[model samples]
Target chain A: MNNIALGRYLPLNTIINKMDPRSKILILLVMMITVFLPAGFIGYVPILIFIATALYFSKLKLTYALRALKPMIWMFIFLLVINVLVMRTGTLLISWGWFKVYSDAFSQTAYIIIRLTLMIILCTVLTATTKPLDLTLGIEKLLKPFEKIGLPAHVIAMMISIALRFIPTLIDETNRIMNAQASRGVDLENGTMTEKIRAVLSLIVPLFVSAFDRADQLADAMEARGYDPSATRTRYKVLKMTNVDYFAMAFALVVFATDLVLCWI
Target chain B: MEAIELEHLSFSYDGQTDVLKDISLTIPKGSYTAIVGHNGSGKSTLAKLIIGLLEPKSGTIKVLGQTLTDHNLKAVRDHVGIVFQNPDNQFIGSTVADDIAFGLENHCVPTKDMQRIIEESAAKVSMSDYLNAEPTNLSGGQKQRVAIAGILAMSPEIIIFDESTSMLDPQGKASVNEQIRKLNEAKNITILSITHDMEEAAQASNVVVLDQGTIAAIGTPADVFQNDALMSRLRLDLPFGLKAAKAFQAHGIEIDAVMNNAQLVEALCQLK
Candidate 1:
């Protein structure tokens, strides 16, 4: 259940959550680009404000979003420290033996850290509020223009959606297979590296066999129901561009414009 | 009209020994027929052959009056649908609605008509409430029901349950069987159930016992069950109710060949 809550939908009926998935996707894409714009305070302030407002209306817990960023905090710090240590253009603030810390490096590292943290938070908010199916539909809708260029947009979207749907099921299967192996005296823990690798090998083979079997059955089932990849298909839910979606897209554009202007001035 | 006709069909996975050999059978329209056998008894191989998933090594298969061939395979598929054994693997859509709509999409069903068909099929399987629910969260039986609904939405003339209930618990199996029965009765759809469960086979209108790539017996359930030696030689276990009835008869008590536990219980209650 906890595993499901990681990136699962919360069903909150807020405006941000109710916005069209395509708009939310477009907003996220533009917001990502805005985060990389060069600015000291102006660029980040607007982004921070936008994200905060979206999160507030999205009704997603701040802590849950933060938890998604927890694993990357160490990497962020490592990059910050590396940037400070490697740059030699700015004035040296401190020297310890051969290592030096520069004034500009401190500001640069701070910028890197804040940009990354905000980017993660914003992306997390997009995923937390939108249903996985809606996300797939949104992505397919975005890819529609490329379909004329032989993109196979629907196939790609279906693959992604099916992969996302099976993740939890695969996790459970892995656990079940691990327990079955454990009962058969395959020690998973308290082992040498080679032994651990061997244990993983044992688990992998059965998991792969089951996955392949599933794929075979899925193919047969799809074929029996008249599924053909090359055939043009009708979609059940046609995405409508609502007023709320228009508003959200406009807001994203305004923020993007401001970020670009901030970088220029 | 014959819903399905297999004439002297032979199939071999490899070029060597046959998985199914010289099989001939005819299923009447609107009939519930069960093919019972042990694992590797070529029951599933027979089903795959009928569905045009596998070509016979020799002979011909006619489904719904159309002769199945590589050239006309797609046309044959439009009239027949199958729900395979593994419920988890067979669900192609992310959600219940999407899964059932998958078939409709393939058929190029108009958007408005698709919704009504989806709703009707879901209602048939009692899965109307779970339209938006993810397939991963569903139980084995519920997933199978969703799979059935997917088939039902296509409105195929014949629906094949290829050991679809073998993976579920007793309750799950019971509910799935009940839904299948309802589909056959309410819609007059022909059903071909491939299973090893004798109890399920006993309830069917006809039972085809397959052994060593050939039909050992094909008749009404009572007529087929009367051939005790052949069934025993095929290593097929009799249904529990029939076994209990036989056991009572051996002790100088008269009990007919009841098909289920409830019938057996009621017969025992009637004793003076």
Candidate 2:
């Protein structure tokens, strides 16, 4: 199912892949903030173009890149429909009783869709460009100073990387288990939602049992190999932001600032 | 100098009744030794103690003459690498190449040397072609090889395998065994494997049988497997080839020399 692609999707040798993931994340934040600038085509067009270009540079194909839009399709439609019919402002293209579709509503709908699309594409760029481990490392680096106040930034970020690392493994295991059970008369996909839920119970029990078994074995293996989460270990793969990363981030920042100024003007 | 030496070592997780008691053994430099024992028989605990993964409740464990201690734990790890029973657990990286590089990275080998070390280690295990394959994409045999490559890249003086091949099928196990034997023979790296398979132990230069956390027997594979009561107690089932050889010996068939399957086969062929 190419579900393994859900794990770290970075191309191994790209220059962008080498950028400190923390820097990529900062650019994502800036772009996300710009998405909410006052509703106008003038504000959104730039963010969308910028996000598209960022993703393109990250080596992700635009077709697969746009699937990020699938999850938001219903929300976008709902927002556009609601804004056009319920807002009732400016020139009316159509009016039905108290409801009206205005020219302003059309502009607002375009603004919301563009903003959502841009923000989604920006996040996809971050994920597509950065290795999960590097992203976790970047997060740890960004949050390191707050450690003095009792936060476990490295541990938390490492947890995210571990979570990301295991997702594909778990999905594969789940599929294998499900297929095995299906062969044994477990009607997981053939029943009502409630029945399917019950059918999954058979699958979950063994999965939980195996998962715990695997975890304990892993704990023993890790402990045997000198894996101490609390111990400060040396990094083998260090992340350093290059001049290009800085420029890319700076470019994102400038675009955000320009969007804000236009919104105000 | 001994690669690993243990004297009267005993351990219990709760610090009460000993799990491994009065266990004394020494592994010579570059010896390929196999430890066979049933569940709860302390074979793995001994391996853990040798590497300082677990502290002994009593007695001494020495690796290359330095005594095992909490302070030198990292130092011990630097000199030793362990592959666990479950290949799923030991993996620290997403891709095959990345996993192989993990230990080398931990030792902080420079980046330029890392790629080559990874390639060589993978090649040693016949995994060079799949360097970029995700760990999740590999089979059990391949995963164990990746685990071996991880440890091999560390260039350890001693490598321990704790039933690492148990989950693998016959072909997978044989491929892994062939690789390990080559490493032990070629690199002079000491190997201490804790396995349930007597056939694998038969291939080793020596076998250590553990029962109830004690060293029940220590000798060549023939010397150890001939003790039926001791073998049964330790769950050290003899490999079929060896069993057949033993049966031929009981049939009043006399041979000047006998060893593994091929040797026994040759002994039978002499009858013509």
Estimate every model's Cα lDDT from 0 to 1.
0.87, 0.80
Compute the lDDT of residue B206 as modeled in candidate 2: 90
Q: Is the docking of candidate 2 incorrect, acceptable, medium or high quality?
A: acceptable
Candidate DockQ values, in order, are: 0.76, 0.42
Q: Write the per-residue lDDT of candidate 1 for residues A1-265, one digit (tens) a residue.
A: 3365456677787777767889889989999988998866668888888888888888877787788777788887887778877888788899999988888887887888788788878888888788888899999999999999999989998888878877877888999999999999999887999999999999999999988887788788888888888888898877778888888778888888998988879
State which docking tier applies to candidate 1: medium
Clashes of each: 0, 0
Candidate 1 local Cα displacement, residue B34, angstroms: 0.8
Over the stretch B30-99, how does candidate 1's per-residue lDDT look in tens digits?
9999999888889999889998888889988999888897888888888898989988888888889999
Question: Who wins the TM-score comparison?
Answer: 1
lDDT of 1 at A263: 80
Superposed model 2: Cα runs more than 4 Å off: A1-23, A55-62, A80-109, A137-153, A183-185, A190-195, A230-232, A240-247, B13-18, B57-59, B108-113, B228-235, B250-253, B265-272
Please list all clashing residue pairs in model 1, or write none if there are none. Answer: none
> Listing every candidate in turn, what is its Cα RMSD in Å to the true structure after a full C-alpha superposition?
2.0, 3.6
